[model samples]
Target: MGLNEAPLLFNFEVESSENFTFIPMSVRFNLDRFGLRITLAQWQMLPLEDRKLLARFPVDDDTEIEPNFDHALFEMLRTHANVEPEWFTPEEAPLWRRTDSVPEGVTHQAGLAGLTAPSVARWAELDPFKRYVLAKLSRKPEANHDFVPAMKEFGGGA
Candidate 1:
């Protein structure tokens, strides 16, 4: 499924072009959009250049770039990183893709973080990638640290 394209990286993530310890939100968004999954370790096994490609690839109807991210990414993962791709079951509507409602997990994390949750109207205003970051961060306790930072960066008076 083609999704709203997102930036290759976000300011909230603790990333470096050198090590890239965490997978950027853009890669995660594209992976979910394309239904392919790779673990952090598998990502680490990839060469820096290959990881950069995953971050920057269009994975959409950009005729010049590879239209299928899953296929090309798995090829690189299998060949260069020797990692098998895992597939996530598709949801009827992924949280990030829906603009009509705010996700509960995100609300929960925001509450715990002592931050107000983004409103339905505000949530709808954000791009899917920002929604993806919020939804993903909120569900993962270890990742909750990024929730407020992401909200602040997304900037609806957060």
Candidate 2:
């Protein structure tokens, strides 16, 4: 996600040893999931000592850092910001989507939609995430037993 969408928690400008220039860094949290994104203008801004510390862990291209690193990073950030981490139960987590983006394959499936007019209509009213789940379940190559249950759970089926 871009900076606009992410909630900015902190911004740090660290001095680089090479040219004594200050580099901009930001710590942003994504509401889509529980994660943080750290942006550094140049990799050189990271101290060799800090690099050595993180070398033991696998850092992937995706912003989702390793759990160990994540915990340490958050702890360090919390210490700097003087704030505690907010906790949320599963039930309190934000819903993934609010509208459906239905695919043509799903709309045209005779076997899937022929006998489920009411369910299909109800599916249109479900949140995008629920619709996505149902669509995915419906498109499986193998026998799909979960579609009906999912529809029922969402009040889509009789």
Candidate 3:
């Protein structure tokens, strides 16, 4: 198969699929984990089908049937966008995968959004991608906040 199925997305990210304007967290998570650096301009340079292919590829443990997802992305960008893939090492120990404690940024962002932060047990219950979404959403200051929607979608909020 040339492409995998569409990876699961947070509700907020689904809107971007209409034009592929913003990168989906599913793709972003994998990019960060795999050390691939795809810029907004670089993403826009690729054809929609290539963008969709990147979005569809899975990075989970269940992805054994697929060719290496990052390699596919790199090749697509190189072939279609005519751009060399930039690389950066991602975190050796990402904070999102921690279950013992909720990150300060997550709690702070949730508090600012007026949402209850996930408790340690609740945090531990999340799949890695969900945890990854929360951590990424909360790690930075942004005018458009998705942390609340993500928290609610993830059942960390009412």
For candidate 2, write residues 25-94 as lDDT tens digits. 1221121133444433332345544333333333222344544555654554454444444544322322
Candidate with the larger lDDT of 1 and 3: 3
Compared with the true structure, what per-residue lDDT tens digits does model 3 show for residues 1-158? Answer: 44556644667777754567677887787788777778888888887777776777665633445547778787878887788767897787788889999988888888787778899999999988898888888787652367787788889865
Question: Quick one: ranking by TM-score, best first?
Answer: 3, 1, 2
Alpha-carbon deviation at 78 in model 3, angstroms: 1.4
Report how far off residue 23 is in candidate 1 (Å).
Answer: 1.0
Residue-pair clashes, model 1: 0
lDDT of each: 0.73, 0.39, 0.76
Candidate 2 lDDT score relative to the true structure: 0.39
TM-scores, one per candidate: 0.81, 0.31, 0.87
Against the true structure, whose lDDT is highest?
A: 3
Candidate 1: stretches off by over 4 Å: 1-7, 14-18, 59-66, 141-143
Q: Give every collision pair in model 1.
A: none
Q: Model 2 misses residue 49 by how many Å?
A: 34
lDDT by residue for model 1 (18-114), tens: 3577787768766777667888888888887777767776534233355566776888888987778888775657676688888988888887877
